[model samples]
Target: MKNLIVASALSLALMGGPVHAQTSAPAPAAAGAKASSDPIVVMRNEQRAARNAFNEAARPIRAERAATVQAAVDKAVAEAKASGKDPVVAGRVARRQATEATKPDFDAKMKPIIEARNEAMAAAKARRDAAMAQR
Candidate 1:
């Protein structure tokens, strides 16, 4: 799901072109510079590759943490329902409690990965914007 979101955002970014891109197709580069050799483009590709690797490494940890939190919520909801309380309210309470209870452990496991991904993406965006502005 995180992969899907990252892919979606990049696809949208590429398909939409730069925010200030002209409607008319751009002319060939006057400097004979290939996009493959463009530093900004290369950096973007490298950042994306790093993000993919981070996602791969973090996937199992995320899945395990999710399963643990979900199990807690399920048990709480089941117990509440068995006692005849409203499942909706019970689920809401259970979700909050379970998430809070599990947050510290989850953060310990995933926070750095999340922050690094965000930071890398943000730096890439800044680089891309600066490159576009230089156009």
Candidate 2:
């Protein structure tokens, strides 16, 4: 649950870039530190950067890959229907085929950005854990 929250927060933080740039008011500081100097603040910034980079890198490839996946799924469904499979079964098969066909390319293209984000999240988690331990 906590991990899910972290991932969601990271995604949201990254999707639109930095919050400070988007808002007129200054960002609130982290406890005991200036906002800019806070570790979590730094992590969030890093995540935003990674997200921006990923978006730029993935934009063209993503569209092409999505089209490929949709085409594959459509073909799969048509073939299954031609074989007299039930509609529900055909749809499921199509979905599975689409995922299988796209997974490798998607991972190849997105792995670096994902790794950076994961590393940032892990570091933040470690800091949070250590802080709790000291308390």
Candidate 3:
């Protein structure tokens, strides 16, 4: 009688087993639908805009620097002539001096841009490091 009860319990448990249904649905597409706008086209347009802005911003600086250097050269030539030195030698010396004089100004103008670029690169490196660590 105990054995019969055990068999009955086992049969009942077997009949009450959990059931799972197999899915016939296809897998979802790997990526979202293609962007309405092409990425390459957008990137190229952005690049063009950046170039235009850079050129516009640089124009005044270039013109000002040219004027300053020219003035320095002219002054040097005049002084050299007054001192009875060769005009060519004076012009060469003036160019060297003007280049030296402009160094500080040029560096000053570029410092912020350089620092920003360095900061951006550092941030990118940090992000990359974090991503690699996750992997």
List TM-scores for all candidates, in order. 0.57, 0.45, 0.52
What is the TM-score (0 to 1) of candidate 2? Answer: 0.45
Q: Give the residue spans of candidate 1 off by over 4 A.
A: 1-35, 112-135
Model 3 lDDT at residue 71: 91
1-135: candidate 3 lDDT, tens digit per residue:
999999999988776663312244443531232221344444444444545655666667767777888898999889989999997798888888898888789777756655655555555456555655676
**Candidate 1, 92: how far from true, in Å?**
1.5
What is the descending TM-score order?
1, 3, 2
- The residue pairs that clash in candidate 3, if any, are none
Worst 10 residues of 2 by lDDT: 26-35
| Window of ten residues with lowest summed lDDT in model 3 | 29-38
Lowest lDDT 10-mer window, candidate 1? 26-35
How well does model 2 score by local distance difference test?
0.72
Per-residue alpha-carbon lDDT of candidate 2 for residues 41-117, written as tens digits (9 for 90 to 100): 66566566656766777788788877887787777778877898776677777778887878898888878767876
Kindly give the number of clashing pairs for every candidate.
0, 0, 0
